[model samples]
Target chain A: MIDPSGWDLPSLTDRWRSATPFGHVAIDDLVARAALDELRQGVSKEPHWPNRGEIFEMMASGPPQQPTPRAFLEALGGPAVRDALAAITGYRLQRVDGNSYVYLAGSYLLPHTDHRPGVDRRIAYVYYLSPEGAFTGGELDLYRCTTDGSGDIVATEIAATLAPRPNRLLLFDVGLTTLHQVREVTGGARISLAGWFY
Target chain B: MLALHRDVLSTDERAQLRATLDAAGWSAHDLADRLHLATANAGADDALFARLLDLANRTTRPLRLRAFQWLRLRRGDYQLLKHDARERPPAAHVELIVDLSAAATGEAELVYTDGGATLFYVPQLPGSVAVIERPPALLRYQRYLCLRVADAEVHRLRLTLA
Candidate 1:
């Protein structure tokens, strides 16, 4: 059974609708045991070859590349999350692509946008899996892009960040107005599942 | 801002061009000339040039509706270069990584550059996504973080192509 406790879906839908540049709806305890077990088994495994600039950092490149499978991604953006997305946009959702990253202590992620040019990205969903007390200082920053020229306040927008919440998922539109990046993980490992919806 | 040129380049292509422009110190006039040439030889010269010119004009205009199409496509790199040129730093180049365990706890660092070598983070970099802040207690009900930096500085670094 799915629980909507602590979440006001109706209000969240409105938030998504009224969001500037981009908006996000978050899920708590998104990672269930079944999902985590599947993810653990699939660690270090690579998905099919990503098209162009689709693949960023390679987990397999690290000291030990774990085996991650399609099931892992599906678990990250599971039925519950998809249902929420469908409710928000009134459209069925599909997983465009998914990837994962692992950060050890003292490691940091340079700030950057996810989807590249010419890519057909619609929505982006991210799930954080940092072990409790295992690390510190990893956060996702979402920026609202605006233009201020001369003495005029021509344009304004909103940008929000979601901290590293264990078993939490964040869903948002990946449009131009949605400018986001991840901050470096300071002390421990920060694992995440990020991909887009077409 | 400029109007949506009927012949505005594809969103992806436009984004690529914008990233290139940001890195190369190119201008609208330069982009306009290139757009003209790119569309001129594509066989539908008039329609394409008209669109390009429209885009240039609309983007130059203040309102975002004029550039909504590109915006929908998430052409932020271009939008920043064309529109937010003068905004100062606090802007950042963030690269997100998912750990092998698929967790959100890990160590990461910011590396700045100036067309030469990937420079180290400096207080003098003009702008940077320097720090992360804790959310207000009222908002702690959810997981989230915010970055601080000058908007101008984020654009100042210009993207370095692969």
Candidate 2:
């Protein structure tokens, strides 16, 4: 269990800044389980496939579906997360969202980026619902987005993979550099809640 | 043989993949061309090189496939592709408007241009709605009016052509 009070956000900010292409986040089991429970009780429905990287995300939106609540977002959007965001862009956050996703067995997501030029959001954050050691082979993979102004997209993917440890929050800037994706789930169901802060 | 080798495919499997490629309107030469683009210094006609090309091209649409594939590939990566000022027609514009509203913690109207329907998110009823816009079968896209209630904060969403 993470004592949110004990979490020293400045240190966490250091970790995030030093985090390579793989990225660093704050997650604890209690926190992860709480987030998961919120997702489970929340409705599930078809998600909008808006662009190149929204396959698993489709299940979180649309009719009779469970959308994430402010409570869950509040839990993940602690002072540390906010501070980390501030450190990255040197700007205060106007709002944070808890965009939830629940994936049954065999769900997979391809590699891509989170920040587009038109959107006014900045950071991308995630909280893993499935506990570590509960399942096998659901690893979060990060990629580097290499592009020029002319719409040429080239992604050089890093091989480092992160296990879905509950309560751990994966956070990063969805700017011109960060490109990322989740590998296919090889075993049981995987659940997570993610969002961006404006 | 319990498991197949990673790079070296059995003779039967190799032939099967080759046939599948042909069915997909691809030739060994066509596959080679794709590989050459992915690889540096296109050394055409190298035997060792051809085997590597065949192995890589066997996979379908690795970059963009169904939803799961997209999630897996973007595990640690987060990005936003682009935004535009281009004017969208009623049908296409509604989807964009809904996506933006649903993206935040607010309330708004989702207009479905094709169907001339205005959808709202009522937390009490709390359900999803699919609106058929652009009636003729010729138009491919359909609009789904989605109301996402997060944290007691409700958002009205729509999906239309961009």
Number of the top-ranking candidate, with DockQ as the measure:
2
Q: Candidates' DockQ values?
A: 0.02, 0.03
What would the per-residue lDDT of candidate 2 be over residues B1-162, giving only the tens digit for each residue? 011122243445434433433344411110100010111121122352233333323421112111100000011221111101111232321111111111232322222222222232212111222222232311221111122222332221222321
Model 1 docking category: incorrect
**Model 2 stretches astray by more than 4 angstroms:** A1-4, A22-24, A29-58, A61-69, A75-89, A145-151, B1-162
lDDT of 1 by residue, B26-119 (tens): 2321120001001111121245334433433343432111111111101111122122223212333111110111111211122233323433
Candidate 1, position B48, lDDT: 34
Task: Give per-residue CA lDDT, model 2, range A1-198, as digits (tens).
Answer: 234555556776677767776455543443545655655555333352322122233335322234444455664456764664576446587777765565554455545566678887777777776555655555777754455687554336454566777656666667655656566555565666677877
Clashes of each: 75, 59
Give all TM-scores, in the order shown.
Answer: 0.45, 0.48
lDDT of candidates 1 onward, in order: 0.41, 0.41
What's model 2's lDDT at A193?
A: 69
lDDT of 1 by residue, A22-115 (tens): 6677777754666665564555353323221111222322222344445555543567756767777665876546666675543333333455
Q: Which model scores highest in TM-score?
A: 2
TM accuracy, model 2: 0.48
